[model samples]
Target chain A: MAQLTMVQALNKAIADEMERDSSVFCLGEDISDKDGGFGGAFAVTRGLYEKFGEERVLNTPISEILISGAAIGAAMVGSRPIADLQYGDFIFCMMDQLCNQAAKMCYMSGGQVKVPMVLRAPVGATQRGAQHAQSLEGFFTRVPGLKVICPATPYDAVGLLKTAIRDDNPVIVFEHKKLYGGKRVEAGAIAPVGEVPDKEYTIDFGKAEIKREGTDITIVANLLMMYRAMEAASHLEKEGISCEVIDPRTLVPFDFDTVIKSVKKTGRLMIVHEDTYSNGWGAEISAYVAEHAIYYLDAPIVRVTTYDTPIPFSPVLEDYVIPSTERIIESVRQLMDS
Target chain B: MEAKMLLEMYEQMDLIRTYEETLYYLFLEGIMPGSIHQSHGQEACAVGMLYGLRKTDYMASTHRPAGHDIAKGVSVKDMMCEMFGKEDGCCKGRGGAMHTGDITVGAIPANAIVGGNIPISTGIGLSLKMQKRDDVVVCFFGDGASNEGAFHEGLNGAAIWKLPVIFVCENNLYGASTSIKNTLNIEDIALRADSYGMPGEVVDGNDVLAVYAAAQRAITRARKGEGPTLLELKTYRIAGHSRSDGCAYRDDVEEAEWFARDPIELLKNKILKEKIADEQILADIHEKNEQIVNEAVDYAIEAKEPSVDDVLLNVYWEGD
Candidate 1:
């Protein structure tokens, strides 16, 4: 095992998948180049163009609809395509393709066709303003046919990406901009440099990883917020408030068992996400835990998420809006005090 | 057009017209489940563009997909079953009228949203190229769909990659009730194809031979790795856009002018003028196709509905 950044792990996963499957290919804007293409907006696909060549590492125009819809069509045929969107906010441009075409093709075709394509987009408020910043997991998780995965660490990124590429359905991998540590670094990035194995490995969906073991409270988070939750747990430990941090890697195929077990142990649940609070992924978790594990919980479910407003361009407001370590700690303290 | 091809297209056109007429009557009787996007007065464009295509080749259609699906060789009985929401339907009763298709015959499920299938065609072409196959994909849309974001993006992508895809815009002179004259500045939708650096041709959609010849050139260019070509079939929608539309927006004079140039009527006249087939042979073919549709209707009415146990099946692909 070696320490690799999330971007490096993702690049390795794509290269490995391309090498393993001849039908596997990638298409996006500025993703292809023999001499180190833009490697995508976050440099995740760096050097894939030279290794896989133009046929596999195709460079498309700045058309999100075409990128996504073309990937759906290619996946409908024989090829397994990995389509990349420069930013997650651009996903709205291909909403028809993703929510309608890709999501309904298999069902609409009576299970005759399989759209085995992967759409990778860098999500989260990275100070790029409203047009570029948005956590799209909530939008996609509500979609029945599409699988949504958000890997925070390098190990999960490589493993889940491989699984997503190999899965026989449309999978959307929402990579957090702050977690992607490479040549380009974000202003307030917390690079989760975990050890990724050298040998091929795949992490299955619906399995939540417990980041920190504790017995006071359970914090369920994913993507960048997962790191924030861990930091909150570290801070809360000093004040005699132990918190168990759980990263439910995939929002669609959620590992509720792990979350339930953690909630049962702690007797408290606090769900956090970078998405807006209104109808956020955290709300779903809160509801599920309330319905199933309510008897075990000693306190009401607390949710820490972004406000129901657009991500601000100003760093101060953005930081204030997004759930920070202090906010998570304060929420934990309130739950403890209550 | 050759006699064999001409007669085949005529028979298919007749079948589509009869099928559409039958559906119109059925919908009027309140027997149909969903709203209909009938493709009347545009049979020549669908038949002429799809009749020459191989069953292995792919085609994506708009909401009005019965003509294209039938032309692309989707089973009549399955399409009927789908319309009836029967278990034996092409999509196992999952897809209703608007989303009709049989992937086994290379007709992707029809896109109800306008211009939704254009970029999908580009991807299908990309897949064909990646798989090292010569098969081409044809994307059928309306003049209004040409203005959608998917159209520009899909066409531009196909052009740059030289993907084997034909973007067929059935300029039926209307985007629903809105007139093309008011919506678009250009008279011909083919002119927009120039923006993508591909050759665009405008064809007389009322004349099957003209549409057939134009489609042949586009298909040939695509097969030769020359890139995509846009074919604008200048046609008109004789029927309302949907079931609720009364077509009050269309003037009687305009309707008569287009009705006089009906594609089926035009094709029949051409066949008779060229002495391709006698009146008896044409009548016999029409009678046969009508009988087929009649049989499909009967089968669909008698087909079984999906069981309660299977209400959960075929949502996500459980591969073999």
Candidate 2:
């Protein structure tokens, strides 16, 4: 076993897949030095070009539509393409290609065609402002034909990415920039390094990871919010508040069973995310629990999320907008007191 | 070209026209469940470009795709059933008229979004080139798509990769009511290829032979690894953009002029002059096509509507 950042773990997963399957190739802006920039905005594909060469690790033009559309087309034929979108916001430019074309092809072709494609987008607020700091999993999760995977840990990042590559349908892997834990010599950085396994393994989708187990209340979160939930739980424990922290690693085929069981035992639930309050990923989980696990709940399911507004570039404003440890603790205390 | 090739092109154009006319009637009667973008006057472009294509070769179509789908050899019965939203349709009743397609028939569904299929077509061509296959892809789009960024990006990518693809812009004067003259700066859409360093050709779209000749040259260039060619078929749409309106925005004088240059009438005259088919034989072909169209409608109406469970079946492929 070896420690790896989420970015390193994603690189490992892509490298492993490309090495194992010749059909697996990556294309995106700044992927190859010969073609220009240095392997993506966050450098997740850093040094892949040296190992796989320029062909497999292709650097495409700054055309998001072409990048995603090409990936879909290649996947349609025989190749499995892993398209790296530098930021999640740019996905809006290629929405028709991804949402309409790639997602619907398999279903439209009556299962005769399968778009085995993976879209890697770095998301989360890191002082990048409204355009760059969006947690795009909420938008992608709403789409039916595409699989949405959000990994909070480096171990899960590597495992889930490998699984997504093998999935016959299109999968969008939303990586929180903060969780990648890569060293940023820039002005501001919120990265946290984590441990990952060197052995080949895969984290199955629709499975939640119990980060911290307690008897009183369950705090469900994902991505960056998962880390905040843990911090809140630790703080709550000091005050005799037993809190269980659970991270639903994937959002689409969500781990509803785990959340339901955790709620059944704890009899209280608080969902947290970075997306806006209205129609966020939390709404789906909350609606599901309300429908299926309402009788088990001893308190109303409280949702802690960002205010419905564009993420501000100012660090203080962004910090105030995102789900914070204090907010998680406050939501937990409210649910517990109820 | 051989006389048989000409006859085959004529037959393909006839099939496309008949299919559109059939769909038009079905849609008018409100028998068809969804709206349709009829390729009523765009038969020459589809048949001319696709008639020279191999079955393994690929093509991407615009919203008006019945013509291309038929020319690509997608069964008329399946398309009709799909329009009726029946279980036996090509897309299993999931895709309506705008999205109807059969990958098995080398026709990627007709994308309703402008320029949506352009980059996808380039990807298909890239796949063929990567696999060392000589298969060429013909991407059919409207003149409106020429202004789309995807068209520029896809063409540039195809040129750089030297992928075997033919970008066919069927400039039928209008894009869903907005005329090309208003949307585009340049008169000839094909001339835009100069920016991408590709050979651009403008052909008489109503003249089936001329369209076929241009397509043959472009397809040949692509097969020889000369990269893509932009073929702008200066054509006209005899019908409305969709089921909604009847070309009220279109100039009546211009409409009458294009009607005189109808691809079907032009092809019929050529067939008669070339002695390809006598009037009796042509009448017999018409009778047979009418019977076939009638049978397709009957099959579509009688076909079973998909069950509720069918919606969840093809969402993903489980190694099948």
Residue-wise C-alpha lDDT for candidate 1, range B234-285, written one tens digit per residue: 9998888987888998999999999999999888988999999989999999
For all candidates in order, the CA lDDT equals 0.90, 0.86
Which digits, one per residue and each the tens of the lDDT, describe model 2 over residues B182-294?
89888798888898899999999888888889998999999998999999999988888887878889887898899999998888888899898887877777777778888
Worst 10-residue lDDT window for candidate 2 chain B reads B1-10
DockQ of 2: 0.68
**Stretches of model 1 off by over 4 angstroms after superposition:** none
Per-residue alpha-carbon lDDT of candidate 2 for residues A1-338, written as tens digits (9 for 90 to 100) = 87787778888999899999988989998876555557767888888888888778877888998898889888888889999988888999899998998888888766668899999988888897899888877888888789998987878888999999999999999988877655453343446567776678988889999999999998889888988999899999999999999999999789999999999999999889988889999898999999998999888888899989999998899889998899989888877888
TM-score of 1: 0.98
TM-score of chain B only, all predictions?
A: 0.98, 0.97
Question: What share of the reference contacts is kept in model 2?
Answer: 0.62
Looking at model 1, residue B217 earns an lDDT score of: 89
